[model samples]
Target: MQIPEFSKEQSALLARFLAEQKDALSLAQTHGYLFAVICAPEPLDVHQWLEQVVPGCDGQMDEQVLFAFMALYQQISEHVFETGYSLPVSLQFNSAQQPYLDMQECQHWSQGFMLGAQGYIAKLLAAPQLASELKEALETAQQSLCFFILDSADIASIANQHGLTEGLLCQQQYEVMNEFAAGFAELIEAVAVNSQLYNDEGWG
Candidate 1:
């Protein structure tokens, strides 16, 4: 299906709406979180997940705005399922923003993803064979969130300790985050397949 591209204007609008709802996650984070949830082994109900992330979404958002968000969700889910990759281009920090703000937003996106994944961690953990890989990916993503918590002094100190420029450190973190996303996508596919096999065997 040809899903409409999630445009900047829509992003801004959603951000504003989320802000009005006193949501902790920005539009970017929310999108990232939802994308992760959609890629889960046994995905959450789309409408239920939407309501959780976007409070009052069904009642408050106009038809057009609601449709746009749903379309974006569907598109991301389909992309991940068909391609075995998350929509990194769409999920990444917006470069047009100031560097500091971009970094902060990236942290928020990671936090949101972690929060989303926590809901399914129990199920994933129950499968001991997959637990270690999923846990490692989650830990790497969690580490990425630490960058936003450091003061300038702390950041500089850490950079110096690593014998790397601050810019290089940030770039390294970005690469790690990308790897985390890819790892997560693989986990999701594995879980989905396992669930299918279990069902096929009438193991329910």
Candidate 2:
């Protein structure tokens, strides 16, 4: 699937709107969470999912901004479902402008991802057919996601105590984010396998 690129101007516009609305997740994180949700075995309606993840979206944005937002979402959905990996939007940020991942923003992004996964998690957890290793991986990912929920000041303090620099902290965060993405991808693969089996044998 060909992913559409949003120009810098368009991104700035969307960022402005999200800022004005005091949205918890940044535009990039919003896209990331939406991508994960779309890659799930049982995906929700796009419009409904967007409405839940981004409240007041329809009412607050002008048509152009709204269209751009949906276009980005579609691009992310296509990339995740087709390739089983998230688009590397996180890498686009430069260390100069934003030296490190803000703890608060990371928390918001994790919260959004957790919210998006709520519908599918119960079924995933209850599936007796899932392998033990995969289940453990999923559980570990859940715990990692929760780590971001800690207070930014406290996290910073802990990092300072450990003598971690901004660059080192950013690298650690990326590693964790990569692990989370890999875990989700594994779960999605499991879902696909189960879905195929059910379709073949009518046993879902």
Candidate 3:
């Protein structure tokens, strides 16, 4: 089925609306959250995830605004289903005139993704019947994404686990962005292939 794409103007409007919302996820964060929702082993309810994306949206959202947000959600979900992990990460030029991802934007995006993924990932990994190799793959993928989202202490821990010194990870932020995108693709592929196995009673 061909879905209408969320145009740049609509995205701008959504960003403006979100800015007016108290504690609402930023546009980048919303995109990240939607991406995670699509990759989840089981789907999350639209209303529930909408609430997460825009706190108190159900109680007070304007109808047009709500419709636009829902369209945004549907577009991202469809993109993931069709294209796997095409991360909507923004890039900027460094001092040497080299292009690299905007780390701050990546951080916000990853933060949103982590929030959406936490419960689903925990449940997926905790399944007693899950295979060891797949489990390891998921853990690694999670860690790669976590590097951008975690607190200083947790980020340090991951860096240390990989035999890197403190703060060294930030030195290669662009490389980590590539790793994050690769990991997300891996996760989407893994979950897509094994989706039926995860569609248990409560999740359905």
* Candidate 2 residue 55 C-alpha distance from true site, Å: 2.6
Residue-level lDDT of model 1, residues 1-204, one tens digit each, is 466777777766777767877554667677677766875655677676777777556546676667677776766776666755442433244567534225666656666676677655555546555546555654555466335445667777889999988766766766666665656666655553553432433323
lDDT score of residue 201 within candidate 1: 35
Taken over the whole model, the C-alpha lDDT of each candidate is 0.62, 0.63, 0.71
lDDT of 2 at 84: 51
Between candidates 1 and 2, name the one with more favorable lDDT: 2
Candidate closer to the true structure by TM-score (higher is better), 1 or 3:
3
lDDT of 3 at 26: 91
Runs in model 1 lying further than 4 Å from the true structure = 1-3, 56-60, 83-101, 126-158, 191-204
Q: What's each prediction's TM-score?
A: 0.70, 0.69, 0.76
User: In model 2, what is the error at residue 121, expressed in angstroms?
Assistant: 1.9
Clashes of each: 0, 0, 0
| Ordering by TM-score | 3, 1, 2
Error of 1 at 27 (Å): 0.6
